[model samples]
Target chain A: MGRAILTLLWKDLRVELRTKEILTTMMVLALLILVILNVAMGQNVVTVKLAASGVLWVVFTFAATLGLSRVFLVEKERGQLSGILLAPMDRSAIFLGKMIGSTILVLLVEAVALPVFVVLFNFPLGGRVGPLLLPLFLGTVGFIAVETLFSAISAQTRLREILLPLLAFPVAMPALVGAVGATAKVLDGLPLQSAAPELQLLVAFDILFVAIGLVVFEYVVEEE
Target chain B: MVQEDRRAVEARGVKKAFGRTWALRGVDLEVRPGEYLALLGPNGSGKTTLLRILATLIRPTEGNIRIFGRDPRREGEECRRLLGFVGHDSFLYGSLSVSENLHFYARLFGLPDIPARTRQVLEALGLERRAHDLVRTLSRGLQQRVAIARALLHDPILLLLDEPFTGLDAQASRSLGELLASLRQEGRAIIMATHNLNEGLEACDRAVILLDGRVARVMEGPEIRGERLREAFLATLES
Candidate 1:
């Protein structure tokens, strides 16, 4: 099992690195959203840019959905699900590898985007930023798990690329709400204890979404 | 009917329906160890449906299936470990090179000496030269060969092949024929669902004809030859 997960993870990570499809597109999209934010917030003076941090995180979360769907699009287009299913490993391992791969891709974009946002918006990203990282990571985990499973399920259906976000974002609203709420506190200099419930909610979202995905994976893999 | 005979795999009065469309209307058949059985039928005749039931991919609406005396419905995970399937499309991840695909599955099957086993399977399938090639870059025949290798990696005792010969050329089909024969020699029971009647009979010890989701007839040995098997397939289709 360990070997299977590692190999699967290695395969996804390696291909993603070579093609640079997921990271490049997502990073560019994140940057573009920041550009739009600068223009829109330029007209306002109510600390809209500061509030835009939460807005920007939401934007990244939603935009990352596109990258997630595209990641699996190659596999589905090439009929590679059958290949993964036949790999003689626990099907859950594939789900985990995909989740990890997308999570890393999202984080890569996040790393660069944060510094750029801090520099451009000038909101002092270090105001208890150490604590804020927790929500970002939790939200990313939940977001990726939901997206990975939906990608697998939607891969078979028609309009797969469109269907992924439709299924993912609606089912993921709870995590989204929790991350936004918890992050607002982290950026405002609250202690870790103040952010605990929302953090816990994100964790619950991760665990529950993963469990649901694992249960339905066999059905999605079965040839209809 | 649960025949008291020594059966390697058996399905009794199995029925499955998807929505209002009934795919199988009580499919009952049995094969003992080492038997090569071909399931012949036209599309919508329920060949794949019955195979999936035996594979425990879905439950039969009404009926039971046992493989080696174990109820597949109740013991799907165990049944899965003992069974291998190769279908029309090989489900090899195109991004992963051949060796990585083999190694990944080896780990999934929890095999010790994964490198050795993967190497052996690749060599046996004559894929050693292309083991580093991405599956997307391989020819259809080569990809199907890799699909067969994926199935054989676990050394399953029972094999279910759905249209396994679809994209293969003569040589690839012959190699596959040889592989199944070798498995039969080692006491494995095989079930291949195919539309190609001629090749189906040539590869199997018995050919069972299914008509609109039921077993219509069974032919064995010398009766399964040349155009004769195709005629049987047509008869099943007509019925």
Candidate 2:
């Protein structure tokens, strides 16, 4: 089981490394969102600071969705998903592998996007930035778990690009809210303890989405 | 008492429906170990659907299927281990090289000594020479060969192929025919679904014509020779 999951993850990462399809698309979109938002917001330090967490979450969510939408569609391209499904491993390994892959791509995009965001908004990046990782990481895990599952379901549809966000955003709302709230607390220079409730909510959503994904993803990918 | 005597596949009353339409109403078929069976049918005749169900890619709307006596629904992982499937598509990633694609599947199938197994299949399919080339760069025949190598990586006992010769040139088709003959000789249960009746029936011990989601006729031995199967094909569907 461990070998299968790692193999699946390695396969996805290797393909991404070669084509750079998912990561490049995600990074470009993240940067574009940052540039567009910076122009619109007009360097209002107070407004930018207040909306920073929301802006960050919005950027990550949209970019991650764009990337996640292709995660399973790549497999569908050459009917590779059927080949993988015909392999003798537990189906949930596929979900975990894709979720982790999407998480890694989203995180890499965030790593680059965060700095540009700070520079664009003229926000200081002192000790306050340290606590933001927890929410960002946890929120991504939860967000990816839901999106990866929906990505599999949506990839089978004719309108996959349009369907993924519609299906995932509603389901991933709690994690988004939790991440934004926790990020807001962090940006405010509050202690990590002050953001405990939001952190807990993020953790809860992560556990719930992952657990449900493990159980339900197989059925979603199954053909009628 | 030998494993060779056991049935490699046994499906009974298998039915599959997509909403209001039915793809397979009741498909009862069996294949012995080392036997070659061909599934022949017209468009929308449920050849692919039946293959997909036996491959466990889709559930039958009704009925039971067993791979070497193990229920596919109850023991999918084990059943999957016993079978290899090659659909119409190559199923190889265009960005990855031939060797990379095979190695990926070898690892996914949990084959021990991945390099050795990957090397063996690559050599078998005559893909070792082009192992480093990206799949998209390879000719269609080579890509299909890579797909076959990936399917055979785990050394399954049952092999299912759907329209494998659809796009092959005459030479490539001949190569595939030779490969199928060798696999059949190795005692693997083979079920090939193809529209090329001449090529499809040439190497098979038995053949079945499917129409409207049911097996309309089964031909064997001398009955499958010459123009009989083709005659039966047109006659069955026309009726």
Candidate 3:
């Protein structure tokens, strides 16, 4: 199982390295969203700082969804998912491998988007980078775990482009809300303990979805 | 070996339905070790559905399927390891080179000495010269050959091919036929679903014709001759 999971992750990364299709689109879209929001919010630094966390999530969620939707669609389009399904491993391995790949891609996009986000919003990091990384990492994993499964489920449908966001956003609302709250506290320069409630939710969300995804992903991609 | 173990595939009363429509209903079939069986039918006649079920890509809505006497429902991983499937799709990454695609599947299957196995399959398929070419840059015939090499990488006991000769020219088709004959010579049990009457009939020891998701005719040995099986196929469907 470990070897198969790693091989799948390796395959995704190797293909992406050659095409640069998913990451390039994700990064460009994230940057565009950040630039537009910065301009629209105007020169009000105080207001921007207050809204930065929510705005950041909006960028990440949309970019993450865009990338997540394509991850399975490519396999479906090329009919490679069937080939991968033929591998002699637990089907959950595919889900975990895909979720990990998505987590890495979203994080890479966030890495670039973060500096630009701070520069444009005029938000001060103030040595809070450590606290901020927690929410970003947890939040990305939480939603991606959910999105990756939905991406596989929806990739089987004809209206997958429209169906993926619809199915994912509602299921991921708790994590998204929790992530926003935690990011808000960190941006406000409050102690990380103060955001414990939201952080706890983020952690719980990550565990719940990852568990559910592993169990049900075999069924989701089974028919294909 | 046990009598059941001597059979490469055994499916009983297998039925598959998608919503209100049934693709395969009450389908019973069997193939012995070292046998080549051809499945022939019109479109929507459930050839692909049956292959997918045996491939363990999809579960039958009803009934049971066993690969080498082990049920796929209980031992899917084992069943999958014993079989290699080539559907209509090449399942190759267009951005990656031919060797890279084979290497990826080889690793996924956890084959030891990946480079040696990869090189052997490449040379066997005559893909050695084009190993470095991107899959998208290759012709459809070459891509199909690469897909076959990918299937053969794990050295499976059974091969399930669906419409493998669909779009190939005469030369490509003839070469593919030679490859299948060689694989058969090595004692692999093969179940090929094809629309090419002459190629499919000539190559199979037995042929099953499906109509409306049920086995309508089974021609064995000398009964699988070209004109006779073709007439039987048309007659079965006409009924």
Best by DockQ, which number? 2
Candidates in descending TM-score order: 2, 3, 1
Q: What TM-score would candidate 3 get against the native? A: 0.97
List, residue by residue over A83-172, the lDDT tens digit for candidate 1.
565444566777777888788888888888888776677666565778878899998889888889888878878788889989988898
Candidate 1 lDDT tens digits, B1-239: 11223577888898888878899998889988778999887787898888767766567889889977888656666777777877655767777788877776677777788888998999989999999998879999898888888888888888888888887898888887887787777777899998776454565789888888888899997778887777766766666
Best by lDDT: 3
Best-first order by lDDT: 3, 2, 1
Q: Judged by DockQ cut-offs, is candidate 3 incorrect, acceptable, medium or high? A: medium
- Output DockQ, candidate 3: 0.79
Provide the lDDT at B163 for model 1.
86
Calculate candidate 3's fnat: 0.84
Give all candidates' CA lDDT scores: 0.79, 0.89, 0.91
- Provide the TM-score for each candidate, comma-separated: 0.87, 0.97, 0.97
Compute the interface RMSD for each candidate structure: 3.5, 0.9, 1.3
Q: Evaluated with TM-score, which candidate comes out highest?
A: 2
Interface RMSD for candidate number 1?
Answer: 3.5
In order, the TM-score of chain B in each prediction is 0.93, 0.97, 0.96
